[model samples]
Target: MLKFFRSIRQRLFKQKKFKNYILYAIGEILLVMIGILLALQVNNWNEHRKSKGTLKSTLKTISSDLKRDTIRAGYLIEIIELNQENSKAVIDRKVTIENFTTYPRTRSLVTIYQPFDIQTKGYDILKRISEQQENEKDSLFADLTQFYSLFIPNIQKSNERLEKVVIGNLEEFQEFPWFVDWSQGNTTEEMIAYFAISEDYRKKVAAYNVLAYGNHLQLIKGYKENAKHVLERIEKRLEED
Candidate 1:
């Protein structure tokens, strides 16, 4: 193609037609500019396609992570509810050394509490998307932040209270003869000792009062709100159908 154009230019030059030669030169320059512009446009289109694909993948990953976080939030809420129920029993004078199985029940609740904590991995991903300027001002990111912002702090607070319950005051409660003397398979003696249930019993009840119960309930409520907001955002984003 270059050689063909060059030959035509050479023949026109030899004709001594200066005006026609200048017009031909201008036409060649215009064609070359058009070709460059077309090539650049193609390159830009490809780049945009790649960027869109990357953004879609990132959004999908974020959505999946949010769903997983939702499931975990539900589990935590359930455990918190159980803990609250146990605490209420103690508060109502319904818990007793006679039904000493409550101690093991409380221990099991603590075990569930152990695995639970306020995590921001899902939120961290959303922040990363925002930091990268990948999805700024998008409703998905905005709603995600809103949901997590509500619940995470309360969860942290509840976890702290749960820790205090298990480690700070529980040992003192277990030191009583009614509770400690149960290991010798002496339920009858333990029940007999609890007949009067004096000031010592009152003190233990006080410790249980402040430890992890109300806070856990607060966390459960917060988690439900968070999950609800998250689900709403996800439904809206995916509804772009």
Candidate 2:
């Protein structure tokens, strides 16, 4: 094509058709510019498609992470229920050493507290993508930002509160008149009597269950619902193109 254009210019120059030559040159330049523009447009189209596919894949992975989180949240709520029931039995003087096995929820009193470990790797990847697309102001990204911003700290706070209460109760065992001979992991009769009847011990159990763990349970449930909503939004985005 360059050879052809050069031959045409030479012919025009030989014929002294300066005006025609200039017109032909301008047309050639215009054609080249058009070609460059078309090429750029096609390249941009391809890049946009690739970026879209990447976003879809990222969202899908995040949805999977959210699903896992929801299931975990549900499980944590169940654990909270069990622990709370156990605590209520103790608070109400319904459990004792002889009937400890009957209260199946008497599994965790001061040791095992629910600390939520939410998955964030997928969201981290999404955040990087969002940063790259700062100018775009994607509404989906905005929703994600809001969802994560609202929940992450709440989840962290819930876990921290639960830990504080449970661990604080464990530390008090040394001061308790019942746990003086706390050598074995086994619960002693004295400990059972104290937990069942002691007002101080009942208050401690109530604080552990009613204050922090209860709030933790509610937050987990809320997080699960929000996660489900985000997953639904992701599905809609994925379905479009």
TM agreement with the true structure for every prediction: 0.66, 0.87
Candidate 2, 42-106: lDDT as tens digits: 99999899888878888888888898999888888887777777887887888766786687445
Q: Cα RMSD (Å) per model? A: 4.8, 2.6
Model 1 ranges with Cα > 4 A deviation: 102-112, 115-126, 149-213, 239-241
**Which residue pairs collide in model 2, if any?**
none
The most accurate candidate by TM-score is 2
How much is the lDDT of residue 147 in candidate 2? 89
